[model samples]
Structure formats: C-alpha cells, structure tokens
Target: MSQSTLVSTRIDKWLWAARFFKTRSLATNAVELGRVLQNEQRVKPAHAVKVGDILEIHHADQVWQVEALRILEVRGSASIAQTMYAETADSITKRQQRAEYRRLHTEPAAQLQQRPTKRQRRQLDNIAID
Candidate 1:
C-alpha cells in the first residue's frame, strides 16, 4: 500500500472515530486540556498514533486504558468503534469498582430535600467551628 493509505492517523481523529468523543472539537479540546495521554505523557491533538500504542483517557469520572488496534478517518457504528481499541484489564476492574462504590454511596447532593433555613444554617456554622 502507498504511504497515503497507511493506518497512521491523528490522535484526536482516532478518538472521535473510536467514539470516545462526540466530535472532533471535543476530542481536540480533551487533548489540549491534558485529559488524553499517550504513553503516560500528554500529547497534542495532531499527534500521530499507530496500532499497539497505549492511550490513557480521562472521561467523566473514570479513566480508560486502551491499546489502539486500528486507525480510520471516519466515525462508524459503536461496535466498529469498539474494535479500534482494546481496554486494559486494570482499567476494567477499576471502572467496575468505582461504579459499585458510587452505587452504594450515591451523590451527597441527592440527599438534600430543600434549602436549609437560616436557623439550620447557623447551627451548621456553629458546629463547624467546634
């Protein structure tokens, strides 16, 4: 194959094609913001990536560790996207653990019914000072 048909592609584009980001701009922003790390180091959006390179991506409340397996220029179906990378076992375990923890603990904000009255607020402040 000619060099033009090679599998090498930009990291950001691959991220979008792999369904990690909804849009190219979002993928680009993630890289610029340092949420996407290649080989344990931050990389630019245009950084070239090849199969077998490890990518650490921080998305939402979890981090994903995936090994790139293919490079394409266009986004495809979710199943096809999944084939682009293989997630690490450690990442899978940590994600499941975090999900369980979140399920058990829930969000603290969810426990609040309404705004505290002034008297209750004052009581809270007083307790903090002790």
Candidate 2:
C-alpha cells in the first residue's frame, strides 16, 4: 500500500503522532475525558483528524494549542514527532508563567512543618470557642 493510501486513522493515533500524548492510550483517555478539543470544541477518541486542524489540549495546569502540520497513520519516533504538530507560542508562554507562579507561591513542605503543636492548637481552639 502507498504511504498516502493508509485508511482513516484514529484520533488517538493522530494525537500520538502530533506528540500531544506520550502513548496512544493516554491520548484516547484524554479524548474520552473531554480534555481534547478540536477547533475549540471537545472531540471523541474516534474523531478523524487531518492536517491544519487546531487542537486545544488541557494537560495538568496548562493548555496547549497545537496546529497539525502533517498526518501520520503510525506513531513516529520522538524526533519525527516534532514535525507533526507545532505548538503555539502563547501556550508555551502560559505554561512558563504558570510554572513561575507556582514556584513563587508554593511553600516547601519543610517550612509548612513549623506549624504549632498540641498546646498551640488547644490555645487557638479556646480562643475560637470564647
């Protein structure tokens, strides 16, 4: 069969080809959970995707807007994956901003351990009760 004549590929395969998810199953699950959006609309795992489609993928605390550049029937290597989809610059900036904010606002577990003991807790409770 010619390379271009491959039958319709699944959305999960497309997501994997586009490097949206590390595994095909992960992509499928994301689609199933409504975290995968096509043209700003949620799509199903079986959705047929082609080139030039914009996908908004919600991953962790950030959202990714990936523009499809090529279609692949099979999942390619990490190097080839880079050629399939292009991530919008805004998504990268947003993710970086979120990372920076989290780093700045989150307190370390070690510092959180400095909280009061039973005596302090009792004193505070008494104050609240009074």
Candidate 3:
C-alpha cells in the first residue's frame, strides 16, 4: 500500500475484512439497507473508507462497533480479517448476554403458543360434541 493510499477501500469490503459479515455481498446488502453507519451517518456499500473510522453495524438484534485500523479492498480469512479492525468488547458482551436471555425465555412461551395439530383438533371437537 502507498503511503497516501492507506489502502482506501469500499465500505462492504471493509466490513467483510473486519469480519463483520460472512461475505462481501452480505455486507453490501446491509449497507444498502441502511443497517451500517459510519460516524453515526448512514453509508452506501461503495463508500470510501479509511483508517480510524468507527462503524456501527446492525446485525440481527445486536449492534457492533468496529474501529478501523487498516483498510483492504479484498476479503480475507477470519484471522486475517480480524486484523483489519477492532471490535468493541462491550458490544460482544452485550450481544452474548442478550442471546442467552432470549434463548432461555423463548422456549416456554413458544410452546404455549403452538397450535394443535389436526389430530388434536379433531380430538377436541369429538370431546366437545360428546
């Protein structure tokens, strides 16, 4: 990379490089859907990115903050990608806790809400008639 280049890269490629998404296209779709922000401002997939920019990426029910350290135009393996940006520890903790909470709470209520199958429904109908 040239001194001035600082490896100027696209937002999608940066997201993938930062290990935010599994693929470049997924990152681009997230940007296009306004789920990615830079400095609190929404950005497009092709947005030019440089070092020190903070990205807020919304994934599922959680958000991730990544501070860019190096920019690259192409995606790399997870280990190499991890070197491109730094993830905030707080965000990871919050996401893990939220996931654990949801996992514990979702099952009981979901079981209650499950509709009866046709056989069960027929049994209920016969019981009511009898």
Candidate 4:
C-alpha cells in the first residue's frame, strides 16, 4: 500500500501508527472496549480514520483528544508518530493538570511497598470487624 498517499486507514492502524497503543491488537481491543471514540462516538476497530477526524483515546488513566493529520499504516519512530495527530488544546491542559495533581497528591495505597505484616493484617481485620 502507498503509505504517504493514503487518505484514510483503519482506526486501529491509525492508533498504532500514532503511538497511542503499543500494538495494533491493543488498539483494536481499546476500540472494542469503547475506550477509543471517533468524533465522540464509539467506533469499531476497522472504522475508517481520515485526516481531520477527531478521536478521543483513553488509556492508563489518561485521555487524549486529537485530530488526525496523517494516515500511516506502518509504525515508525516516535517523532514520526507524533506528526500523525495533533492534540487539542483542552486535552493538553487537562492532561497537564492531571499530571500535576498526581505529582502533588500520591495515592494513599501507593506508599505500601509490600504486603502487610501479620500484625497489620490483624489490625485491619479488627478494624473491619468493628
């Protein structure tokens, strides 16, 4: 297939090419799970993705709303992948805010490096019982 001349490609392929997912199968799975939406609507993996189409992708607790700029079937370098889509300004701001919030306030459970000791477990049980 002519990679540069193409006007459209599968949504899964586009996601992979844009580096949104590590592999095409993961992109397909995202689409199937409704984590990937085209123009704010859930789409199939095989849905045609054209230049200028808006896409919302959710993964790893992060969301991105981008406009497709290029249609590429083959995965390439990160720089090349980044050029395939342009993130919306609102999406950029929201992601940055989320990252800042995470940096400022870590999850309470994240401090636990290992499973609780017997004493801790007993205490937890006692607390639950009460």
Candidate 5:
C-alpha cells in the first residue's frame, strides 16, 4: 500500500490539518467541548482517526458530516485540506437546506441594522404592553 494510505493522525490534529480549525489548540478545545464527534460519540484529542471514519463536526454555526478519506500530520493549504475528507451527499443537502431555511426565516434582532432609539424603544414597549 502507498504511504498516504498507511498514514494516520490524531483526531484533533487531523481537524487542524484539515482546516476545520485554525489552530491545534482550537481543535483540541472544540473536541473537549464536544463539538467534534467520531462515529457519533465524543472523542478525546489524542484519538487517532482512520480513513472512512464518520466525523460530525460543529464549527461556528454550521455542522459538517464527513468521511475521512486521508490522514495527515501537518496543516496545509485549503486545497490540500479538502482532500482529507469527503462530505456525505446527505450532509451537503441538509446543510444547504439549513442555510435556505435560515435565510427565509431571519432573526428579528438581525433585521435591525442598529439599536432602537429611545422613541422607538418606547413605541416597542407600548406595542408589547398592548
């Protein structure tokens, strides 16, 4: 087998090398925070990841479900990072649908470009009182 095929790395390190997190510390923190799961269960930073392992990662407001395709010990460019995993089709569909849903249903607070003025606040209070 090729060296690439034989290689493996820690889950947290892989996360950093895969560009999932900007730093190893961030990756470790996320793993510790339960934001990263392997096979749907929480994993420690030192847990080694092998190819074909399903990873459920929560980064920012988006969730990713990807299957490990390759493993690496060093962080690389974005293009290289993408080659490490294959995001499932179902995951892609779900994420797209989620984005569309969020777009269609924006938060009320987000709609306001700025905080309400004193007059506007009073009006809002009166409307709430009614």
Candidate 6:
C-alpha cells in the first residue's frame, strides 16, 4: 500500500519503514529506551505518528530531527524511505558537522592492525611497572 494514504501509523512501524532502524523490534526497543520522541515528548512504540508530526530520533552517535511527510507501515527502498521525512535545517547542519568532526578525528582502537607483538607487550608491561 502507498504509505501516503494513511492518516497515521505506529511509531515503531514508521521508524522501521523510514529506515531509521533495521527492524520494527529495534525501533520499538529504541522507543522504550527513550531514544525517540514525538513532538518533543517521549512516546511508546505503539504511539500513532501522523504526517507533519515532528520526531527526534537518536541512533548510534547521531541525532535526527525530522518531520514526517508520509505515514508508512512497510519498509521500502532507500529512495522511497528518504521521501517519508524531511529533516530540519539545524538537524542537517549538526549531522554534517558531526560527520566532519568524526572524519577528522580517527578512533584510537582503529589504529590497531592486530594483537600486540611480544616486544610491544613487554614494552607495555615495562611502562606499566614504571
């Protein structure tokens, strides 16, 4: 069914359909964990989400503030999912800035190619002892 025809859908279903979470259960879990807000208020997974309602979704290290443009119940193509919500300008800017910062600053653990060599381990132990 074309999602645009629906007046409203469950928040979890909408989140999954919009591709915010990988599955409906994940979306529900996120809602229960207080990672999602509807109109600035915490809502249950079954909460009804209508077109034009604002949503704040926090996933991983990024936060999204978007307005629902269509009510969807089924997951769809990425192109179709992108059509369902319109992110606010501030949200877009914040996400971009965060992405840039992450790009510029690498994760410390990411530098490790493998387990430490014996010499490296000994050096680490020596440093710890001192």
Q: How many backbone clashes does candidate 5 have?
A: 0
Candidate 1: where are CA atoms >4 Å away?
A: 1-5, 111-130
For each predicted model, how many residue pairs clash, with residues at least 3 apart or on different chains?
0, 0, 0, 0, 0, 0
- Candidate 4 achieves a global lDDT of 0.93
Runs in model 5 deviating more than 4 A are 1-6, 122-130
Among residues 3 or more apart in sequence or in different chains, the pairs in candidate 1 whose N, CA or C atoms overlap within 3 Å are: none
- Alpha-carbon lDDT, every model: 0.91, 0.81, 0.82, 0.93, 0.92, 0.93
lDDT of 5 by residue, 45-77 (tens): 999899999999999989999999988888889
What is candidate 4's CA lDDT for residue 67? 96
Give lDDT tens digits, candidate 4, residues 12-128. 999998899998999999999999999999989999999999999999989999999999999999999999999999999999999999999997568778998899888878988
The alpha-carbon RMSD values of the candidates against the true structure, listed in the order shown, are 3.6, 4.8, 5.3, 3.0, 2.5, 3.0
TM-score of 3: 0.73
TM-scores of the candidates are 0.82, 0.73, 0.73, 0.88, 0.86, 0.84
- For model 4, the superposed segments whose C-alpha errors exceed 4 Å read 118-130
With candidate 5 superimposed using the best TM-score fit, by how many Å does residue 22's alpha carbon deviate from the native? 0.9
Best by TM-score: 4
Worst 10 residues of 3 by lDDT: 105-114
Residue lDDT tens for model 3, 1-130:
6533666788998887777888888999999999999988998888988888888889887788878888776666778777888888987888799889988778533564578889977877898899
Q: Write the per-residue lDDT of candidate 1 for residues 1-130, one digit (tens) a residue.
A: 6533657899999999999999999999999999999999999999998989999999889889999988887888999999889999999999999999999999645766899789978887898899
lDDT of 2 by residue, 53-76 (tens): 888888777788888777786777
Model 5 RMSD vs true structure: 2.5
Q: How accurate is candidate 6 locally (lDDT)?
A: 0.93
Clashing pairs in 4: none
